[model samples]
Target chain A: MAFVEARDLTKHFVIRRGWFARPTVVRALTGVNLEIERRETLGVVGESGCGKSTLGRCLIRLIEPTSGQVLFDGEDVLALHGEELRSLRRRMQIVFQNPFSSLNPRMTVRDIVAEPLKAHTNMRGSELTARVIELLRQVGLNESHLYRYPREFSGGQAQRIAVARALALNPDFIVLDEPTSALDVSVQATVVNLLEELQAELGLTYLFISHDLSVVQHISNRIAVMYLGEIVEMGNAEEIFHSPMHPYTQALLSATPMVDPETRRERIILEGSVPNPANPPSGCHFHTRCPAAMAFCADEKPPLREINGRLVACHLHE
Target chain B: MTEPLLRIEDLYVRFRTDEGTIRAVNGVNLEIMPGEMFGLVGESGCGKSVTGLSILKLVPHPGRITRGKIWFRGENLLEKPESAMREIRGRHIAMIFQDPMSSLNPVFTVGHQITRVIRRHHHVSRREAWERAAGTLDDLGIPDPERVMRSYPYELSGGMQQRVMIAIALSCGAELLIADEPTTALDVTIQAQILELLNALRIRRGVSILMITHDLGVVAETCDRVAVLYAGRVVESGPTDAVLQAPAHPYTQGLLNALPRPSARRKSLQAIPGSVPGGIEEIPGCPFHPRCALADDLCRSKTPIMTPVDSSGAHLAACHLIGKSEG
Candidate 1:
C-alpha cells in the first residue's frame, strides 16, 4: 500500500450572493485520486482555481471533504475522532503560500514555533525554549532571532520561521502549498534546498503543490496535473515533463517560459481562462479551452486509466 | 545609426521614510531603441518598477526622482513643465501595471475609460472616440468588443481585463509602452497570450516596449535586450542571448544558478547566501557583495563600473571580479 492515498476526494463550496439569493455550489475538487510513497514528494501542479489547494486541505482534513477516503499508513484518516484526530494532526502539518501572513505578526518567533509543541506535547519552560531554538537552528536560523517578530524578518526569513514551526511536531508528512511561490528565485532556492535536506534527514513525505513547472519538476518524484478540480495526468516527474499525454498538460508545459532561450517550445496557447467551477462544462471540464477537444469531449467524462506506464484521463490516449 | 528612443542617464530615486532615506534607483542608465522589447529584470526592492515609473514621472508620494536625465527623442523630460509632461503622457508614452483589475476603475464601464483617455489625448468627437475604443479592443483580439466595452471591469476575466488594459494603453497610438509586470498575475497560458499580444503590437504598431519583470524566463523568451537591476542599481546590461547564456556579473549568474531547472533534478540549487538588504539598511561599495561568492577587499571598498565583457561592447557588467581568476 502507498504511505498516503486519496480516493475519490471531492469538495464543493456553497456561496450565497445575498440574503434572498440561492446558494451556488462551487465544485472545488470534483474527484482527485493519487498516492505518495514513503519519504517521496508528490507534486500537484495546476493554475489558479484548479482546487490544488483544496485537495491539499482535504487530505489533512483542514477542509472537510464532501465525499472521499483518505488513507494514511493503511488507516482511514476520515474515520479518526477526538484524541485520534488530534494525534494525527501532530503527524501532518501544512505550510501556506505567503509566509509573512501565515506567521502571526504579533507573536515572537519562539512562541510561534512553540505553540505547536505546547498543544501537542507537555514540555514547558526551558525545555520548550531549547526545543524551539533547536528547531530554528535546524532551519538555518539562530537563537538571536528567537525574540524577533514575524514583521521584523524578510519574506525568506519568515518562511524559514514557518518551516521551523511546521517541523516543531516532527511531522512525517507536510502539505507544502506554494511554499516558495511568494519568494524570490534566489531565496526560493534556499528554502527548496532546506526542504530536500530535512526530508533526507527526517524521512518526511511532502505534498509539494505549486504552479511553477520548473520548481515542481526539480523537487517532485511524481507529478500530478490538475485541471478544473480533476487529476488529468499522473506519472513520474521526468515522464510527465518529457511526454505529457493530456492536452491541458501539454499546453501548460508549452506555455511555461523556459529559461534557456535556445529551446523555446512551440507554444499552444489555450483560448480562454479556466471555466467557472460553480457551473463547470457538461463533461470534460477542460474541453471548453482544450486545443484538441472534440465533439464527444463535451459529452463524455474520461476516466483515469493506466496507459504507457502512466495514468492519463483523455479519450485521445484511449 | 538612428537616435535612441528612450535614454536614461545617472538616474536616482529616493524615498524618505522615518527610518532613513531609501535610495530606490541609484545611478541607473538604460537605452531603449525604437521597435525593441527591452527587459528590466530584478527581484523585489531592486527598483525595476521605480525606474519604469520614473520614466513617466509617476513615482508615488514620499518617493522623488532626485537626480536623472530622462531623454526621450533628444528632449530631456526633466526640463519639461508639468503641462508639457501631461501632454506627453498617453499621447506619446503609456504605461500598464501588474494588476489590471486594480489599475482599472471599477465603477465605470470599459468604454468610458478608454474613450476618456482617447478624448484627453486627441481632438476627436465623442462618437469617434467610442468607435476607436471598440476598434482598439477588436485589434487586441477581444471577442465581442461591443459587449466588453459595455461591461464593467469586474464582469471580465483576468485575461480579458488585462487585454482591456492593453487596449487603453495602445488606444492613444503611443510610441512607447512601459509594461510593469503586466503578466505576473496571469496563469502560464494566459501569460503566453498576453506576451504574444505584446509582441504583435510591437510589430504591428512599431511601439517600443519596456518590460519590467522579475521572471528571467519571461525576459529570456520575449526581450531583445535586457538589464539586470540590483538594489537601486543596474548591475548588468546586454543582449538577452549573451547575458542569459554567459552572464558576466556574479549576481546575474547567482540568480540564474538559483533557479530550479528540470535538467538539474534532485541536485542542490546554488542559493545565494543572505537575503536582499532592506531599503533603509544601505550597503557600501557593491550592493551585492554581502551575498556574492567572489567578494574581496576591492569589491568591499570600491563599486565597480560597467565594463565591456567582449569585443562588441554590447554586453556589460559591473563587478570587481569580472576578469579576475581565483587563486
Candidate 2:
C-alpha cells in the first residue's frame, strides 16, 4: 500500500443563489485517484480552477471531501474522530498558498509556531519557546524573528515562517499549496532548497501542489496533471515533463517558457479559458479545449488506463 | 550600431521611509534600441519596476527619481517640464500594469475606456474614437470587438480583460509600450497568447517594448536584449541569447542555475547564500558580494563597472571576478 492514497475523491461546492434560487454545484474535484509513496513528493500540476488545491486539502483532511477515501498508511482518514482525529492531524499538516494571509498578522512568530505545539502537546513556557526558536532556526530564521509579526518579514521570510509553523509538530506528511508561488524567482529558489533539505533531514512526505510546472519539476518524484478536477496523467516527473501523454499536459508543457532563448519551441496555444466547473462539458471534461479530441470524445468519458508504466486518461490511449 | 531609441543614464530612485532612505534604483544604466523588446528582470526590491516607472516619471510619491537622465527620441526627458512629460506619456509612450482587473476601470464599458484613452491623446470625436478603439481591439485578435466594447470589465474573462488593457495601451498610437509584469497574473496559456500578441504587435507596428518581469523565461522568449538587475543596479546587460547562454555575473549565474528548469532534474537548487540586504546601506563593494560566492577583496572594496565580456562589446557584466572565473 502507498503511504497516502486518494480513491475517487470528489468535492462539489454547492452555492445557494438567494433564498428561492436552486443551488448550483461547482464540481471542484470530479474523481481524483492518486497515490504518494513513503518519503516521496507528489506534484499536482494544473491551471486555475482545476481542483489541484482541493485534492491537496483532501489528502491531509484539511477539508471533508464530498465522496472519497483518503488512506494514510492503509488507514482511512475520514473515519477517525475525537482524540484519534486530533492526533492524526499532527502527523499531517498543510501550508497555504498566500504568505500574507496564511500567517496571523497580530501574533508574533513564536506564538504562531508554538500554536500547533500548544494545541497538540503539553509543552509550555520556556520549553515551548525553545522549541519554537529551534523550529524557526531550522527554516533559516533566527532568534531576532521570534518577536516579529508576519508583516515585518519579507515574502520569502514569511513563507519560511509558515513552513516552520507547519514543521512545528514534525509531521510525517505536509500538503504545500503554492508555498513559493507568491515569492520572487530568487527567493523562490531559496524556499525550494529549504523544502528539499527539510524533507531529507526529517524524512517527510509532501503533496506539492503548484501551477508552476518548472518549480514542480524540481521537487516532485512523480507528477500528476489535473484538468477540471480529473487526473489526466500521472507518471515519473522527468517522463511527464519531457514527454507528456495527455493533450492538456502537452499544452501546459508547451506553454511553460524555458529560460533558454535560442530554441523556439512549437507551442500549441489552447483556444479558450477553462470551462466552467459547474457546467462542465458532456463527456470528457477536456474535450472542450483538447486539440486531438476525437468526435466521440464529446460523448464518452475516458478512463485512466495504464500505458507504458504510466496512467493516462484519454480516448487515444484506451 | 543604430542609435538607441531610449537611453536611461545613471538613474537613481530613493524612498523616504520612517526607518531611513531606501535606495531603490542606484546608478542604473540601460539602452533600448528602436523596435526592440528589452527586458528588465529581477526579484522584488531589485528596482526593475522602479526603473520602468522612472522611464515614464511614474514612480509614486515618497518614492522619487532622485537622479537620472531619461533620453527618448533624441531628447533628454528629465529636463522636460511636467506638461511636456504629460504630453509624451500617453501619446508617445504607454504602459500596462500586472493585474488586468485592477488596472481596468470597473464601472466603465470596455469600449468607453479604450475610446477615452484614444480621445485623451488624439483630437478625435467620440464616434471616431470608438471606431478606432474597436479597430484596435480587432487588431488585438478579439472577435466581435463591438460586442466586447459594449460589455463591462467584469463581464470579460481575465484573458479578455488583459487584451482590453493592451488595447487601451496601444490605443493612443504609442510607439513605446512599457509592460510591467503584464502577464504575471495570467494563466500560462493566456500568457502565451498575450506574449504572442505583443510579439505580433512588435512585428507589425514596429513598437518598442520595455517589458519588466521577474521570470527569466519570459525574457528569454520575448526580449531582444536583456538587463539583469540586483540591489537596485544593473549587474549585466547583453543580448538575450548571449546572456542566457553564459551569464557572467555570479548573481546572474546563480539566478539562472537556481531557477527550476523543466528539462533538468536536481537534487537541490543552488540557492544564493544570503538574502538581498535591506535597503541600499551604501555598501562599499559590489552590492551582491554578500550573496556572491566569488567575491574577492577587490570585489568587497570597490564597485565593478560594466565591462564588455564579448568582442561585440554589447555583452557587459559588472563583476571583478568575471575575468578570474572565466580563466
Candidate 3:
C-alpha cells in the first residue's frame, strides 16, 4: 500500500462580509486525489495560487480539509483530533519555503532544533543539547554552530538548520514546500543532495512542492502538474517530462529554457494569463488559455482517468 | 556597433554602513551595442541589479556610485543633473522590476497607471494617453484591454500584472530597457510569453535591452551576449554561446554545472562549495577562491583582471587559472 493517499480531498475558505451580509466561499482545492509510495518523492509543480501549498497543508492537517480522506498508512488523518493529531504531527513534519522567516530570531540554533524534541518527548538540559548537535551534524552542520543564531547563517545554512529541525523527531514523511527556492543555485544543490541522502538514510517519504521546474525535475520520482485548483497531468518523472500528453504540460515544458544551446527547443509561448482562481471558469479551468482546447472543453469538465500508466485530465486524452 | 548604445567604464558602487564602505560593483566595464539584448547573470548580491539601477540612477539610498562613468549614446549620464536624469529615466530609458505587483500602485486602475507613464514622457492629452495605454495593452496580447484597464491590480493575476507592466514600459517608446529578473516570479508558460513579447518589441523598434537574471538558461535563449557576475564583479563575459558552451572562469563553470540541463538525467550536478562571502572586506583573496576547486597561492594573493582568450575576441575572463593557462 502507498504510504500516504489523499482521496478526493477538498478545502474551501468561506469569507464573511458582515453580520447581515452573505458569506462568499473560495474553493482552493477541488477533489484532488494523489497517492505517494513509500520511500519516494512526489513533486507537485504549479504556478502561484494553484493550490499546491493548500494541498500540502491539507495532507498534513496543518489546515484541516473541508472534506475527503487523507489516509496515512491506511488510517484516516482528518478523523484524528486533539492529542492524536498532535502526536501525528511528529510523524509528519514540514519545511517551509522561506528559511529566514520560518525560524525564530531570538532563539539559538540549539533551541530551534530542540523545540520539537522538548514538545514531543521528555529530554532536556545537556541531553537535549547533545541531541540537537547530533541532528545538526546529520544535516551537515558542526558542533560550533550550536550557539549561533539564525542571523549568523547564510540562506543555504539557514535551510540546513531548518532541515535539522524537521529531522529532529525522525519524521517518516516530510512536506517540503519550495525548500530550496529561496537559496542560490549552487547552494540549492547542497540542500537537495542533503535531503536525498537523509531520505536514503532514514527511509523518508517527501511531498516536494515548487514552482521551479528544473529543481522539481531533479528531485522528483513522480510529478503532478497542477493548473488552477486541479491536477492536469501526473505520471512517472521520465514519462511526464519526455512524452507529456497534455498540451498544457507540453507548452509548460517547451517554454522552459534548456541550459544546453545545442538543443534548440521550440518554445510554445502561451498568450494570455491564468484566470482568477476565486472565480474560475465553469467548464474546464484551463480551456481559456489551452492552445488545443476544443468546443467540448468549454462545456464539460474532464475527470482524471488513467491512460498508459499516467493520470491525465484533458479532452485530448479523452 | 554604431557608437555602442550604452558604455559602462570602470563603474564602482559602494554602500557606507556601520561596519565600513562595502564595495558592491567593483571596476565593472561593459558595452552594450545598439539593438542588442545583453544579459547579466549572477546569484543574489552579485551587483547585477546595482548595474541595472546605475543606468537609471535609481540605486537605493546610501548606496552611491563611488567611481566610473556611464555613457549613453555619446553623452555622459552620470554627469547629468537630477532634473535632466528624471527626464531621461522614463522617457528614453525604462526599467521593469522583478515583482510587478508591488511595483504597481494598488489604488490606481491598470489603465491610469499605464497612461501616467505615457503622459510623463509624451505631450499627449489625458484622453490620448489613456487611448494609447489601452492600445499598447491590446498589443501586448491582453484580451479585452478596455475591461482590464478599468480593473485594479489586485484583481488581476501575476501574469496579467506583468503584462500590464510591460505595456507601461513599452508605451513610452523608450529606446532602452533594463529588465531585472522580470520573469522570475512568473510560471514557465507566462515567462515564455513575456520573453517573446520583449524580443518582438526589441526587433520591431530596434530597442537595446539589458536583462539581469541568475539563470544562465535565460541568457542562452534570449541574450546575444552575457556577463557572469560573482561578488560584485564580472568574472567572465563573452558571446552567449561561447561562454555557456565552455565557461572560462571557475565560478561561471560552476554556475553552468549547477543548472539541471534537459539533455542529461543521470549526470550529477557539480555544485560549488561554500556560500558567497559576506561584507566586501571579509575575504582577502578572490571572492570565489574560497569555493573554487582550482584555487592556488597566486589566486589567494592577487585578484585577476579581465583578459582575452580563444578566437571569440568578445570572450574575456578574470581568473588566475585562465591567466596562467593562457600564458
Candidate 4:
C-alpha cells in the first residue's frame, strides 16, 4: 500500500444567504483519488476555485470530507476522533498559503514554534526552549529571533518560521498550500529550497498544493492537474510538463508564461471563467470552456484511465 | 531616430512616512519608443508603479515627485499646468491597473462609467459615447457588448472585468497605455487573452505601452524593451531578448535564476539571500549590494552608475563588477 492514499475524496460547502433563502451548496471537490509514496511530493495544480486546497485539507482531515477514504499507512484518517485525531495531527501537518495570516500577531516566534511540541509532547522549561532554538536553527533562524514576533520577520523569514512550526512534531507528512504565492520571486526560491532541503533531510512525504505551475513543477515528484474539483490529468511532473495528455492541462501549460523568449509556445486561450461550482455544468465541469470539447462531453463524464503510464480524464481519451 | 514618445530623466518620488522619507524612485531614467511595449519589471517596493504614476502626475498625496522631467510627445509634462496634465491623462495616455474589481466602479453600470470618461474627454453626445463604448467592448471580445454594458462590475467575472477595464482604456483612443500589472489578478488563461489583446492593440492601433510588472515571463513574452528596477533605481535596461539572455546586474541575474523554470523539475531554485531592504533611507553604495552575491568592498562603499554594455547603447547595467566579469 502507498504511504498515503486518498480515494473518492469529496467536499461540499453550503453558502448561506439571507434569513430565509435556500442555502447554496458549492461542490468544491467532486471526487479526488490520489496516492503518495513514502518520501515523495504530490503536487496539486489548479486555478483559484478548483478545490485543490480543499482536497489537500481533506487528505489530512483538516476539514471533514462529505465522502471519502484517506488511508495513511493502512489506517483510516476519517475514523480517528478525539485523542486519536490529535495523534494523527502530529504525524500529518500543513503549511498555509500566507505566512502573514497564518502566524498569530501576538505570539512571539519562540512561543509559536514551541506550541506544537508542548501540545504533542511533555517537553517543558529548558528542554522546550532548547528544542525551539534547535528548530529555529534547522529552518535557518538564529538565537536573536527567538522572542521576536512574526511581524518582525520578512515574508521569507516568516515562512521559514512557519515551516519550523510544521516540523516541530517531526511529522511524516506535510501539506504546503501555495506557500510561495505571497512571496517575491527571490524570497519564494529561498523558501522552496528550504522546503526541499528539509524534506530530503527528514525523508518526509508532502502534498504540495499551488496555482503556480512552475513552483509545483520544481518540487513535485508527481503532478495532478485540477479543474473544477476533479483531477483531469496526473503523472510524473516532467512528463506532465513535457507532454500533457488532457486538453485542459495542455491549455494550462501553454498559458504559463515562459521566461525564455527564444521558445515561443503556441497560445491556447480557454474562453470564459470556471463555471459556478454551486451550479456546475452537466457532465464534465471543464467542458464549458474546453476548446476541443465534443458533444458527448456535455452529456457524459469521462473516467480516469491510464494512457502511457499517465492517468487522464477526457472524452478524447475515451 | 525621432524623439521617444515618453522620456523620464532623473525621476525621483518620495513618501513622507512617520518613520522617515522613503525615496521610492531615485535617479531613474527611461524611454518608451513610439509603438513599442516597454516593460518596467521589479519586485514590490521597487517603485515600478510609482514611476508609472509619476508620468501622469498621479502619485498619491503622501508621495510627491521630488525631482524629474517627464517628456511626453515633445512636451515636458512635468512643466505643464495641472489642467493640461488632467486633459492629457485619459485623452493621450490611459492606464489599466492589476485589480479590475477595485478599479471598476462597483455601483455604476459598466457602460455609464465608460461613457462618462468619453463625455469628459471627447466632444461627443450620449448616443455616440454609448455606441463607442459598445464598439470598444465588442473589440475586447465580450460575448454580448450590450449585456456587458448593462451589467454592474460585480456581475462580471474577474477576466470579464479586466476586459471591461481594457475596453475603457481603449475607449479614449489613447496613444500610450500604461498598464501596471494588468493581468496579475486574472487566471493564467485569462492573462494570455488580455496580453494578446494588448499585443493586438499595439499592432492595430500602433499604441505605445509602458507595461509594468514583476513577472519576468510576462515581460519576456510581451515586451520589446525592458528595464529592471531595484530599490527605486534602474538596475538594468536592454532589449527584451538581451536582458533575459545575458543579465549583467547581480539583482537581475538573481531574479531570473530564482524563478522556478518549467523546463526542468526537481531542481532547487537559486535564491538571493536577504529580502529587499526596507525604508528608502538611502543605503551607502549599491542598494542591492547587501543581498547581491557579487558585492565587494568597493560596491558597498560607492554606487555604480548605469553603464552601456554595447556600442548600440541599447543594453545597460548598473554594476561595479560588470567590467571585470565581461573580460
Candidate 5:
C-alpha cells in the first residue's frame, strides 16, 4: 500500500438559500484518486477553486469529505472516530499557505511551537522549552526568536515558526499548501532548502500543494495536475513538466516566463479565465480554455489512463 | 544612441520607521529608452517597488528621496512643483499597482474610474471622457465595454479588474508606465494576457515600461534590460538575455539556479542558504556575502562596485569573486 491513498474522495459544500428551498451544492472534490509513495513529495498543482486545497484538508480529516476513502496505513480516515482519529492525526499534519495569518499573533513563538507537544504529550518545563527551541533551530530560526510574537517577525520568520510548530509532533506526512508562496524569492530559497534538508534527515513524506509551477517543480518528486475537481494529468515531475501530454498542462507550461532568454518559447495563451467550478462544463473540465480541444471533449469526460508511462486524461493522447 | 526617455542617477530613497531609518533605494542608476521595457527585479524589501514609486513621486510620507535626480524628457522631475508633478503624473507617467481590487476605487463604476483619468489628463468633457474610456476598454480586450463600464469593481473578476486598471493607466496616452508586480495576484494565464497586452501597447504607443517583479521569468519575457537589486543596491544590471545567460553576481547566479527550469531536472535545487537581512543599520562589504557560496574574506570586508563584464560592455555586475572583465 502507498503511504497515503485517496480513492474517489469527494467534498461538497451546500449554499443554503431559504428554509424550504433546496440548497445548491458546490462540488469541491468530485472524485480525486491519488497515491503518495513512502518518503516522496507529491505535488498537487492547480489554479484557484480547483479543490486541491479541499483535497489536502480531506486527507488529514481537517475537513470531512462527503464520500469515498482516505486510506493511511490501509485504514479509512473518515471512519476513524474518537481517540482513533486523534492518534491518526499525530502522523499527519498540515502547514498552511499564509504563514503570517496561520501563526497566532497573541502567543509567543515558544508557546506556539510547544502547543502541539503540550496537547499531544506530557512534556513540561525545561524539557518542553528545549524541544521548542530545537524545533525553532531546525527551521533555521534562533533561540532569540523564542519570545517574539508573529507580528515581530517577517514573512520568512513567521513561516519558520509555523514549520517548527508543524514539526513539533514529529509527523511522518505533512500537507504543505503553498507554504513558500507568501514569502519573497530570496527567503523562499531558504525555506525550500530547509524543507529538503529536513525531508532527508527525517525521511518525511509530503503532499505539496501550490499554484506556482517553479516551486512545485523544484520540490515535488511526482506531480498531479488538477482542473475543476478533476486530475487532468499525473506523473513523475520530469515527465509531466517536460513532455506534458494534456493540452491544459502544455498551455500552463508555455504560459510561464522562463528565466533563460535562450528559450524562445511561443507562449500558449489560453482563451479565458477558469470556468466557474460550481457550474463546470458537461464533459472535459478544461475544454473551454484548451487550445487543442476536440468536439468530443465537450460531450464525453476523458478517463485517466496510462500512456508512455504517465497518467493522462485526454482523448488526443489516449 | 537615441536619447533615453527616462534616466535616474544616484537615487537614494529612505523610509523613516519606528526602528530608525531604512535605506530603501541606495545609489541606484537606470535609464530606459523610448519604446523599451526595463525591469527592476528583486525580492521583497529590495526597493524595486520603491524605485518604481519614486519615478512618479508616489512614495508615501516619511519615505523621502534624500538625494537623486529623476530626469524625464530632459527635465529634472524632482525639482518640479506639486502642480507640475500633477500634470506630469497622469499626462506623462502612470502606474499599475499589484492588487487590482484595492487599487480600483470601490464606489465608482469601472467606466467612471477610467473616464476620471481621461478627463483629468486630456481636459475632455464628461461625455467625451466616457466615450474615450469605453474605446480604451474595448482596446484592452474587455468584452462589452459598455456593460463593463457600469459594473462595480466587486462585480468584475480579478482578470477583468486588472484589464480595467490597464485601460485607465493607458487612457491618457501616458508615455511611461510603471507596473509594480501588476499580475502578482493573478494566475499564469491572466498574467500572460496582461504581459502580452503590455507588450502590444509598447509596440503600438512606443511607451517605455518599468516593470518591477520578483519573477526572473517575467523579466526575461517582457524586459529588454534588467536591474537585479539586493539590499537596496543594483547588484547586477544588463540586457535581459546577457544577465540570464551568464549571471555574474553571486546573488543573481543563486537566483537563477534556485529557479526550477522546465528542461532541467535535479534531485534538489541548490537553494541560497540565508534569508535577507531586515532593516540593518548598514551593510559591510557585500550584502549577499552571508549567503554567497563564493564569498571570501575580501567579500566580507569590502563592497564591490558595478563593473562591466567583457562578454558585453553593457553587462555590469557588482561581485568580488567575478573579475571586472571576463571574456
Candidate 6:
C-alpha cells in the first residue's frame, strides 16, 4: 500500500456575505486523487487560490474535506475520532508557511517544540528539554536558542524552529505547505537541504506544496501540476520539466522566469487571470486562459488519464 | 556621451530605534542610464528597498537619509525643497510597490484614484484626466477600462489591481518608474504579463525603470543592467548577461549557487551559512565574511573596494579574492 493516499477528495468552502445575501460555495478541491509511495516526495505546484494549500491541509485532516476519503497506511483517516484520531495525528504532521506567524510569540523555543511531546508523550522536565534540544540540533540549531522567543529569531531561524517542532513527534509523513516561500533565496536553500537530509534520515514521505517551479522540480521525485482544483499533469519531475503534455503545464513552465539569461524561453503570456473558483468555467477551468483550448474543452470536463507514461488531463491528449 | 538619467552616490540610510542606529544602506553607488531597465537585487535586510525609498525621499519615520547625493538629470534631488520634491515626485518619477491592494485606496473607485493623480500632476480638465486614465488602463491590456474604472480596489483580482496601480503610476507621463517588487504578489502568468507590459512600456515610451527585487530570475529576464546589493552596498554591478553569467563577487556567486536549478535536480544546494547581519551590529571588515566560504585574514580585517573585472570596466566587483584565485 502507498504511504499516503487521497481518493476523490473534494472540498467546498461556503462564504456568507450577509444574512440577506445567498452564500457562495467555493469549490476548493474538485475530486483530487493522489498517492505517495513510502519515502517519496510528491510536489504539488499551483498559483494562489488554486487549492494547493487546501489540498495539503485536507491530506493532514487539518481542514475537513466536504467529501471523499483519506487513507494513511491503508487506514481510513477521516473515520477516526477521539483517541484514534489523536494517534493518527502523531504519525502525520505539517509545517506551515510564514514561520514567525506560525510559532507562538509568547512561547519560548523549548516550550514551543515541547508542546507536541508533552501532549503526545509522557516525557517531562529534563527528558522533554533533552528531546527538544535534540530536535533543534537536527535542524541545525543548538541549546543556546532554547529560551528565545520566536521574535528573537530571523525568518530562516524561525523556520528551523518550526521544523524542529514538526519533528517533535517523529512523524512518518509531513505536509510541507510552501515552507520556504516566505524566506530569502539563500535561507530557502538551507531549509530545502535540511528537509532533504531529514527525509533521508527519517525515511519520511512528503507532500511538498509550493508555487516555485525550480524548487519543486529540484526536490520532488514526482510533480503534480494543479489548475483550479484539478491535477492537470502528473509525472516525473525531469520528464515534466523537459516535455509537458498539458497546455496549462506548458504555459506555467514557460511563464517561470529562469535564472540563466541564455535559457530564456519565449514566454506564453496567457491572456487574463485564473477564473473565479466560486463560478469556474463549465468544463476545464483553465479553458478560459488556455491558448490551445478547443471548442469541446469548454463543454466537456477532461478526465485524468495515462498518456506518454504520464498522467495528463486535456482534450488535446484525447 | 549623454548624461546618465539617475545617479546615486555614497547613499547612507539609517534608522534610529531603541536598539541602536540601523544602517540600512551604507555607501551604495549606482547609475541608471536613459531608457534602461536597472535591477537592484538582494535578500531581505540587505537594504534594496531602502535604496529605492531613498530615491524619492520616502523613507518611513525613525529613518533618515544620513548621507547621499541623488542626482536626476544632473540636478541634486536632496537639495530640492519639499514643494519642489512634491512636484518632482509624480510629475517626473513614479513608484509602484509590491502590494497593490495596500498601496491603492480601497474606498475610492479605480477611476477616481487614477484621475486624481493625473489631474494633480497636469493642468487638465476632470473629463480629460478621466479619459486619459481609461486610455492608460486600456494601453496596459486591461479589458473594458470603463467598467473597471467604476469598480473599487477590493472588487478586482490581484492582477487587475496591479494593472490599475500601474495605470495610476503612468498616468502623469513619468519618465522613470521605480518598481519595488511590483510583480512579486501576483501569480506567475500574471507576473509574466506585468513584466512584458513593463518591458513594452520601456521600449515604446522610453521610460527608464529601476526594478528592486530579490528574485534573481526576475532580474535575468527583465533587467538590461544589474547591481547585486549586500549589507547596504553594491557588491557587484554590470550588464545583466555578464553579472548573471559570470558573477565576480562571492556573495553574488553564493546567491546564484543557492538556487535549485531544473538541471540540478535533487542535488544538494550550496546554502550560504549564517543569516544576514542585523545591520546594527558593527563589523569592521567585509560584512559578508561571516557567511562567505572564501573569507580570509584580509577579508576579515579590511573591506574590499569595487574593481573592474575586465578591460572595459563596465563590470565591477568588490571582493578581495576576485583576482587572487586566477593569479
Top-DockQ candidate index: 6
Candidate 2 docking quality: incorrect, acceptable, medium or high: medium
Model 5 TM-score relative to the real fold: 0.95
Q: Per-residue lDDT of A1-318 in model 5, one digit per residue for the tens?
A: 898999999999988889998888888898889999889999999888888899999999999899989999788888989898988898899999888789888999999999999998999999999999899889988899989899988887788899899999999999999999888776777788788889999889999999988778878889999988889899999778767899988888788788765544579988879888778888898889888889999999999998877889998986
DockQ of each: 0.86, 0.71, 0.63, 0.79, 0.60, 0.90
Clashing pairs for predicted structure model 3, backbone only:
none
lDDT tens readout by residue for model 2, B126-203 = 999999999999999999999999999999989999999989989888889999999998889889989999999999
* TM-scores (chain A) of the candidates: 0.98, 0.98, 0.97, 0.98, 0.97, 0.99
lDDT of 2 by residue, A244-279 (tens): 899999899888888864334678899878988999
TM-score of chain A of 5: 0.97
| lDDT of the structure predicted as candidate 3 | 0.88
Cα deviation of B109, candidate 1, in Å: 0.7
Tens digits of per-residue lDDT for model 1, B95-182: 9999999999999999999999999989999999999999999999999999999999999999999999999999999899999999
For candidate 5, the lDDT comes to 0.88
Of 2 and 5, the candidate ahead on DockQ is 2
Predicted candidate 3 versus true structure: per-residue lDDT over B1-327, tens digit per residue: 368889999998998888887788888899888789999999988999999999888889789998899999789899999999988887888899899999999999998899998988889999999999998988877899999999999999888898888788889878888999999988878888888888988888888899999887788899999999888888899999889998899999888788765555534666788887654585666878889889998878888888786765789999878646646
Model 6 lDDT tens row, B1-327: 878899999999999999999999999999998899999999998999999988899999899998989999789998888899898887889999999999999899999999999988889999999999999999988999999999999999998998898888888888899999999999999999999999999998999999999999999999999999999999999999899899999899999999999768899999988889899988878888998888999999999999999777999999998778879
- Lowest lDDT sum, 10 consecutive residues, model 1 chain B, at B318-327
TM-score of chain B of 6: 0.98
* Range of the 10 consecutive residues with the lowest summed lDDT in candidate 2 chain B: B261-270
Q: Classify candidate 1 by CAPRI docking class.
A: high
